[model samples]
Target: MEATTTSQPKTISPPISPTFRISGGRRFSNDTSVAYILPSDQDEVKRLKLNHDLWKELMNGLFKSDMHEQLTKGIRVLDVGCGPGWWTLDMAALYPNSQFIGIDMADVFVAQDLPSNVTFEQMNAGTGLEFDDASFDFVFQRFLVMGLSVEQYSSSVTEMKRILKPGGAIEILELINDYSNASPAFARIGSWIHQAMSARGLDSFIADKVSSVLETAGFKNITDVNYDVPIGPWGDESGEMFLSIQKLALPAVKVMVTELTDTTVEEYDKTEEQAYKEALSHQVSTRFRLIYATK
Candidate 1:
């Protein structure tokens, strides 16, 4: 009988970000903070639940083959800008051995009863994290473009690298700003939102730059995955979910735009409404990009 020797796989140290902190500044006023810090709006909470459920389902379908083995084990995960904590909770349940921490500006929407492994914190992503270095096995974030500027995005990625354990992974998911289809009206509205965001120094189209940003932040072995996420009232499988999400998103867009642009609230609202109507008649597309990088 011949004995075969198996070689041990080489392990590489994950990327590490320089120790630095960015000031969040007085971004939110006392009144605005009171409103945002309070319990999340009931309608918005429901929409988040629906959106997470749809996303989980979609991910399962899309990554069917890898879901069971890779995602269902002991993995320490950190979710930055984890709105409502849906994904964090789901991941906690899915990976019982894994611990999940969700950090967001508001903790109002987080579940009152979370699993033992799940934790929530109210922290700004632009600043330094409270956690110790090399703490997590995976760092995950999604749809964070709204709250982050390009500089902040770069800084946050570097922060994620710092807390990630050797050989750990970082995953970032974001959507493109362009959403236009059969109905030109939705396109018009999307354009307005895009312009507003751009004007405020926020890049709604930042998805395209994830890879470069990660690389610049010292991440290696980076993989970029792009998917087309449909928006509006189209009849595609994810269309209903998209429409529901848009309903909530449109209002948020208006508020953010008004705050950033110092524009009249009424004008922003009108623009959002018009864009939503156009979205219903057309099949708009939003680009979703997922950057998976290993330290």
Candidate 2:
């Protein structure tokens, strides 16, 4: 968490209109090189923002990384797979002295009156991170379960390790797509999502394997925390919000999952409806893993 650089943060304007291709009444990334299948339209933006707020509510803060001191003094930070730049923008506001760079394959940058220390870049982290070795004091990525395959995730971990300065911290947050204690209705929905992800070379269950990836990349002092969060009215206010998030998330991936799994749209819709009912009838939960380590 020690400061590695004292460089001033830079500001860059984002593209006002990013390119996208329509699919199944939703919009997705136009870049074929990137493997992320989720839609990048305004609806998707709403879902991502909701998910970010849910995470903040659950974690009680922006991130779990232990680098606030370094960030306060000044350092370079990188946010990989930063869809919509929610996390990056919040962190930038929290640490004005730190320079923030949020990179994503899709051109979904937040182009408002952005802080001078914040910037967004479009790039695929699966191939590699476009930065010098030991260049950043902090590197972060979250919820990239659909964006990268196992090999690509491993490669990105190596890239993150390579770009992190010595004594610097790197944090990753991910979740399993399937829920524990899943009802029959919810199980069907999870099955379709898992199968679709598998067909695309992505593991919806990658949340459990990230610590090993970080270890192989030579990161040290690793901290792996698994949070079992509820997703139903039975669990209270947070659960209610997460339940709402689930409603949006399933539909968000409907276009990709149905197309990839060869499942009829009618069937997906039916199962998804049943899953919501099942969630309310009983308690269903999922685990989110927050892994942080020093390089």
Candidate 3:
């Protein structure tokens, strides 16, 4: 968690206000060469924000830590890869006395109307963050596993440590590589995801290893919470949310996995259709893991 530079935290104003809409779900950003698997446009950003709401509902709250209850005046919080600032906005509304800052690679959907305590900056986490050491009371990251390359994982953990004050909390939530009890079609999609991510120099299996990385980076009292998120039209509301995420990610998944399946784009159409049917049958399950620790 060492700081290599003495640069102050810089807040750059976004050129355009954020806007969102639902479109054909396409992954892979046309704007940047960053090794991300998902697009950075408004539709994808909105989809990601919706995914956050689903997680919050499934977990029963915004955070699992008692520290969240202790949020008071003057507390500083940093959200890494905080797409659209949804979580930050929610937390800011709940804990108005605390200050919340969100940083992401793109400004696709940063809220224009934020509480006084909330603000957002556009930055890449893999590169060093522009913050002094021990600056924040809490650091939060969600679904950034696929956004960073495998080699950048340790440095990202270290960056979190460097920005967190003594006894500060760090919470990471990610979808694990494991898709248990899945039907054949869903399994094929899962396989394609793994291969697709690897092709982009990212690791789909990093969620399980995050705790060890945090430990090595000098974090302590780590706890890992795991949940099986049912995907399909079954399992009520949570399942519906999961199905939405899968469908939104399908277009990008199609491009990335077509070569791996040894099929032309035309031939892959049938595979996607069968996969959609399997996903609707309530037979697929994906594991979501949450790892939290103290610095």
Candidate 4:
């Protein structure tokens, strides 16, 4: 991707830390607007570091080609709900002339040092964005299920389209919750997690419906790119990657189950670990859908 240079350099301030809690028996934390739990905090920095390492391996294994090829130089890019700004930093490095703005509700895990062309903002995806209309060349949102509901997804898509330049592209990436290829134990665990997430207002499996949502938001030339991302604890190089993900997901699962139900965190962890072990016995896969469209 080529980078775009502007007269004004973007600046991002450090974000304050917030308290966190688990409301149900789910793995993801529900962060109140005033106070939030971010996995990238100093206390949980180890998890963040491991997650980033695994994420890099996962992305590399999944997309062998240059993943940022479409983001050309001199373009304006916006990443909504960017966590830790890994992708943002990678894009900035790939295209130095391009300006990247990453917006999230909490900035607990944002990089301490950002490149000159990249900036981050603490903002809610469900509310107002501090940007002008048609201000961005490309808008990227990934793994947003934790932060938005179906309605919010639609609204966010509309807002993204509004900020995108005419004929600009928007990419929405998400994972499917169902484990069609997983063992029965893993499938059951996945189902429970999906239902819990739905109850908490976040749908873990929304990739299939995203295309229609994008279409409803007045996007044209929409295309869906689907891939089966493996998710069992073992297999090959990718299996090792999945193992790391499963480890990282333990806390998020604890947050979800304990917050929503009467289940103890220890019990939930044990159950999830068993399910993950069973899942590894089979060739399990997670669905990754990348919906791309033009304004």
Q: Among these predicted structures, which one has the highest lDDT?
A: 2
Sort by lDDT, top down from the best: 2, 3, 4, 1
Estimate every model's Cα lDDT from 0 to 1: 0.65, 0.84, 0.74, 0.66
lDDT of 4 by residue, 20-42 (tens): 33244222234553222224343
lDDT of 1 by residue, 1-295 (tens): 1112212222122122232211221123132222121123444456656666666655653222123354556767888887677777666665778788988765443555567998888687866677889988788888777667767778888899999887778888787877635355566556666667676567877889999988887888888887777775565768778777877766655554555455576766676677667666666766688778788
lDDT tens readout by residue for model 2, 258-290:
889978999989988988888888789887899
Assess every candidate by TM-score: 0.78, 0.92, 0.86, 0.80
Cα lDDT of model 3 by residue, 129-181, tens digit: 89999999999998877788877777888988998999999999988866788
User: TM-score of predicted model 3?
Assistant: 0.86
Worst 10 residues of 3 by lDDT: 1-10
The weakest ten consecutive residues by lDDT in model 4 span 1-10
* Local lDDT at 3 for model 4: 28
**Candidate 4 segments exceeding 4 Å error:** 1-71
Which of candidates 1 and 3 is the stronger one according to lDDT?
Answer: 3
TM-score of decoy 2 = 0.92
